[model samples]
Target: MVTGLKPEKMAYYKQLHAHAWPGVLKKIKECNIRNYSIYIQKIEGKYFLFSYFEYVGSDFKGDMAKMAADTTTRRWWKETDPTQIPLPEAAAHKQQWQIMDEVFHTE
Candidate 1:
């Protein structure tokens, strides 16, 4: 998934992730999501964040709901969501991250 980052909030965003909340991290593991990573890049004078993760759970939807219901996760989003700038299409639907289609993968 991808989202644009506010230039002004770039440092703060990285700082927040540097010492991520322990409870939130615990919840993410409990939800069966692993190998998660986020990368930032400057593209055409704009900053964007790309996030990747592997879901090891059977029920993706249910696991997501479970994560969403976690108080710690909700709290983490409160601090991080404001640092993002959703793309036009995603903003139209009130979403923060835009889903990226996987065109090719080899393991």
Candidate 2:
């Protein structure tokens, strides 16, 4: 998934991530997401964020719903959501991140 990062909020975003809340982290693991990572890039003076995560659960939709129902996760989003700019596709879905299509993969 991918999203645009606000230029001025970059530091705040990095700061929040540097000291990620314990409960939020725990909830992420509880959702069966592993080896998760986010990378940033500067493109034509704009910043974009790319996220990669491995979901190990059978019911992805159920897991995501559980995550959304988590208070800690909601609190975490309150801080991080403002730092992101939703692409049109994402905005249309009222979401901060847009799904990406995978063209190639190698193990």
User: Residue-pair clashes per candidate, as listed?
Assistant: 0, 0
- Clashing pairs in model 2? none
Candidate 1 segments exceeding 4 Å error:
none
TM-score for each of the candidates: 0.96, 0.98
The reply for model 2, stretches above 4 Å from the true place, is none
Model 1, TM vs. native: 0.96
As a TM-score, model 2 comes out at: 0.98
Query: On residues 1-107, what C-alpha lDDT tens digit does candidate 1 reach at each position?
Result: 99999999999999999999999999999999999999999999999999999999999999999999998899999999999999988899999999999999999
Q: For model 2, how does the per-residue alpha-carbon lDDT over 6-73 read when each residue is reduced to its tens digit?
A: 99999999999999999999999999999999999999999999999999999999999999999999
Per TM-score, the best of the predicted structures is: 2
